[model samples]
Each structure stands twice: as structure tokens, then as C-alpha cells.
Target: MNKLILSAAALALMAGAATADTVRMGTEGAYPPYNFIDDDGEVAGFEREVGDELCARAELTCEWVTNEWDTIIPNLVSGNYDTIIAGMSITDERDEVIDFTQNYYPPTASAYATLTEGADMMGGVIAAQTSTIQAGYVAETGATLVEFATLDDTIAAVKNGEVDGVFADKDALVPFVEEQGFMFAGDDVPLGGGIGLGVRESDTELKDKFNAAIDSMKADGSLNALLVKYFGDETAQY
Candidate 1:
């Protein structure tokens, strides 16, 4: 009889917890390693793993939503989702629009890739995905900047001779270089202050929960494990 009472109480508590909070995790499912829709049509990758773990640690229910990169922040502000678990960098400009949790991914390098060695990175035409840090960096290089709607399109431009090179995250370009005969051109240009979860400015309580979860992951070494699992040890330096 005592066991039955305890079981009933456990069930009631679980039900109540389930009804507590369900933060929507928004991401650009196009970005590989960071977040992507796997062959199973479910969100998978580093961010997905980390985000789900954070939710678990915080004891908060969560769901995933995919959005385009360009309009992601706008949609977040408009309440299309509760949090952005995308590989978005924490910047002062962005911080003005929406608050950010402590960084989950350390700052990584942006690099240029081209089919030809010693390609003119100075005044040559370069392709960059719109609204990315790479795009802005390329613009400052005195190179003609060609904007693409997607990362794949930017790479395609490089192969098609429409652009002299493509600028993007170095790790994201690894597969392309191996498969497409492209070589890393010039030095790796460092950009962004590191990636973090974006939350609405009004959602201070939600941000606190996520920050606590992030802290726990860091303390337990789970965050570093996830980063190294996707990226290499160099990026896992936290």
C-alpha cells in the first residue's frame, strides 16, 4: 500500500513537470556539424545534442524549429520561436536585438577556399553567404563580394568560376575541399566572439535557466565532449 502511494505521487510529479515549460529551439538546419536535418528528417548535430542536453539539465521541455539564416533573428524577435540554438555568434549588434546565453561553442576561424592556388584574395571576386560574418569580412578585403542565399550556392559559385573563392567557416569547408579539389587559400581569418544561444530580451528567466544548464555542461565536461565530437580538439578548447 505504501509503495502504491509513492508510485502515484511520482506519476503526478512527472505530469506536472511535463506541463511546466517548453522552449522552442530554432536553428538553421542547413548548417552542417552545427545543426542539420539528418537523413531521418530529424534535427541532428552538435547544437542539437548540446541543446537537448541543456534542456534535460534545466528540467525544461523543448522542441526544435528550422528557419532560414537571413531572417532568423527577425523571426525570433517576432516570437516564431523561444530560443535560437543555431550557430549564431554573440556580437554587440546582435546583443542589442536579443540577449545571449554564455557561449557554447568557442570562436572558430573563417577561411577562404579556391580551386586555384595563389588565387587573388585581394581584388578577386569572392562568394559569401548573405548576412554572415564571413560576408562582412570579405567585403572589407577589397575583393568584390558576391552574396549567395545559401552556403552551397557560395561553393557552387567557386566551382563554376563565378567567383574566385568562397569564404566560410573553416570546419564547414573541410568536406568541400576534400571532395571538390578546392584548397584553403590565404590565412584563416578569425571572426565572431563565439557561438551562443539567442533568447528574447524579455526572457531573462529562460536565459538564466539555459545559462545554468550551460554551466553544468561545462563543469561536467559534456560540452567539451560534444564540441570535440563534431569539431576537432582545437575548437573544443573552452
Candidate 2:
């Protein structure tokens, strides 16, 4: 599921269809804290709660849908989903195809995680979730990039001796370092403007509703509360 594979799939999905009301919110449930399925077999995470409240405030009936991260944006274009609430950043390249709501999560740093120390994140084999900023960054670096469909797969590559390290959002990898004995390697790569909900180019009205919902939460400090609840107080101030 590299960029090339995604482009072909996106074209095919775009020709299919779109949905009616009942906003179909798409996400990569494999990334923890931001989004993941809990033990109850339900979508339960920070973005889940935030999305629900935003839909509530916007008076839009929404349902959660988990899709692979690599094809998430393609599926959005193809009409498989109405919105992407995954931990995606607001980037110029992505905005060319999709509209984004005001950021819900502030700008974040991407870091490398490895099972051993002295790992060369700059040039060694690096695993990253396909079609992500981290993956793009890895390609720019001299490192050999190994693309995986999910964040879990990238981490597994490191643990299973498939790659030297995995690159991803620092916050998303923090829990693993704390609990799984993984070590933080190399300096953090400052990537992403901020995390936002993504919608198709034609859906201006839908984007506006979600934007208003986000602004409402920000103004009321509810968004800050959720940031602390899920990401801890020391996270980016914005």
C-alpha cells in the first residue's frame, strides 16, 4: 500500500459511489489513543468521543467506520465514507484532494522507535504506515523505507527484526515505549500542521459544520479537556 498502489485504488474507488446522511466517519482503529477498538469490540478512543460530540453539536447523525490507513483517503474520495477523523494532519498535499475541518489536535512530532539502542533512523531500514507523513519523511531520508498498512505492522517489523526502527507520531508510539520496552531512537521529526477531520472536495457544507463544531469545542475549552484526557497535559499547548 505505497503511494503508487494507493493512487490506482483511489481512482477505482472514486468511480464507485457516495453516501447520504448518516455521516460515515472513517478512521484507522489500529493507532491507539487517537483511535482504536476497545475490548468491547466497539470503536473507542479519543477521536471517537470527539467525533461523536462534533456530530452531536452539528446535529448530524454519524456512524464510525474503520478502514485501513493506506486506503483511507482513497475510500473517502470513492464515497466509501463521508469524513476521515483519523489522526491525519492538515497538509497542503492532502488538501489538494480533500477539505479539512479546523484542527482538533495540535501540531505533533514524529519519532522513531526501536527495540535496541544506537539505531540509525536516518539511513537504516525504517518502517512507516503507508501514505502517511512519516512514510513520506522516511522516503526523503536516506533510509530504506518499508511501508505497512497499519501502525501495528510497522512496529511488528521492528520487533520481528524486519526493520531497524519504526517511524510514527511520537504520542502514538509513547505507550509502546512505556509498556513494551521499546526505546526511543533518533530525534523527533516535526511533521504535520495539526490533526483535522478530512472530507471530500465537493462537501464544503459538511466541512463547515465540522469546523463550527471544532470551533465551539475550542472556544468552550472542551477540546483542551479532551487533549489532556487522551494525550496528557504536557502535550502541545494548541
Best by lDDT: 2
| Candidate 1, superposed: residue stretches over 4 Å from native | 1-20
lDDT by residue (tens digit), candidate 2, 182-223: 999977889988999999999998999999989899999998
Model 2 spans with C-alpha error above 4 angstroms: 1-21
When summed lDDT is taken over every stretch of 10 residues in candidate 1, the lowest stretch is 229-238
Give candidate 1's error at residue 42 in angstroms.
1.1
Cα displacement (Å) at residue 206, model 1: 0.8
lDDT, candidate 1, 1-238, per-residue tens? 9999999999999997786588899999988878889999999998999999999999887799999999999999999999998888888889999999989988888899999998998789999999888888888889999999888899889889999999999988987888779999888988888899999999999999999999999998988888888887767466
Per-prediction tally of clashes? 0, 0
Predicted structure 2: clash tally: 0
| Per-residue lDDT of 103 in model 1 | 94
